[model samples]
Target: MTEHATAVAALTPAIADGPQTIKVIISGGFAAVYRDMLPEFERSTGISVETGSGASEGAGPKTIRHQLANGTKADVVILSREGLHKLNEDGRIRAGSEAGLATAPLAAAVRTGSRKPDIGNDVALRKALIDAGQVVAPSSTSGQYVRDKVFPRLNLPDTVRLTLEARGTEAAEALRAGKANLSIGPTSELVQESGIEVVGLLPPDLQLVQTFTAAIVSDAQAPEAAKRLIDFLSLDSDILLAAIKRAGMERPRG
Candidate 1:
């Protein structure tokens, strides 16, 4: 067998037999990438993944401070560096298990037929947000990044209105319903929405390049399976990796 096949064989001994179902809680920005790859992952490994993505409130709390404050459970966690660090500090996950998964720049999306606006600069971004009647963003790391950093830098605090504070898919849904004129969140979140058009990524100079990290929970029921899922998600050769990039996200790296 080829070296790659040999490696797979070596890892198979750790695979549990009863069910390949892995319960995972993913947040921050990587959730979209994982969700997109689920079907392919299942087809290849016969493993099932149950995933839920959200902001601080959805995941646990606004900061790792809250995730630690209120105990949350899952086989795996995918969140921002800050969030992961808090989890690590609280002993929620293994110290070294945390690894950078992907980097996504904040992006903007408008309704498919609406006039696409320029968010290339702080001024334009502020105008875009203000112009929109309503906006959707999570209270997660990304939301915090925008609320805490970008908005202040742009000087558009009073102009934009936050319509909803949901997590993951819910943020996208807000955009779809016309409840919000624009959806300002991670690229992964914007890309998953079928009803809206992704205008473009926030300019590099002002971009919040969020680095998402994944960690195996401290006492997972299927630690081996969880590790495999993490490995599969992190694999460079996996088509899902490409899909993540296609969705405008950087691939996970050690």
Candidate 2:
């Protein structure tokens, strides 16, 4: 068994009587990895996890902020650090319970079989945008970053034809449907769709890395189970690291 599984197995017996269910509301940024790890957690802890999705950015009603505002019964939440901080301030999350999970960089993707465009440098990226017919971007963290920061920096705010989608997957879907020639969002989101070929991460100079974090909900119905889930995921094991990498994220540094 993997070291992470071994560790979880060793710890499972101690929480034999803990809550049997954990409900988590997580942003799309880390959804793939969290889902990938759920079965292992259930096997080790005997606790079932129910997950819900939310966008990491935007003030839309479906965003995590709105879910917490409407009193979603979340035992745990995983979202961008900024969003977590807002929850902490609003007394939605337990203070001091936050833990950094992974960092995902922005990436560019094209429909499968499309000629990969060069985005190796600022100049090439600018040219790629200028030459593309339609560009799709999520109206979330990475998209906001590109819209508010990168576009102005590139001095092509009005040059590129941009289509903004409510979520990352939508942006990828637009690319797959031929609605857009290029799509940009978190690498994790881009990698989740099968019909698109991820060109690569944006050039380092233009890259925006978003850090995802997890925390126990302040009024969680299963606080102990939630804390245990956080602890299990925070364990720096090879299995966890590999899963993060496969989900297009990197382990955060100390």
For each candidate, give its TM-score against the true structure.
Answer: 0.82, 0.93
Clashes of 2: 0
User: How well is each residue in 17-42 modelled by candidate 2, as lDDT tens digits?
Assistant: 76488899998888888888888888
Top-lDDT candidate index:
2
Tens digits of per-residue lDDT, candidate 1, 21-130, equal 77777775776677776676666666678875535333445444454456655787778877776667677786567667788888888878889999887677778888
Residue-pair clashes per candidate, as listed? 1, 0
- TM for candidate 2 is 0.93
Candidate 2 regions exceeding 4 Å error are 9-13, 157-159
- Model 1 residue 175 CA deviation (Å) reads 2.3
Give the runs in model 1 whose Cα sits over 4 Å from its true position: 1-13, 16-20, 56-72, 252-254
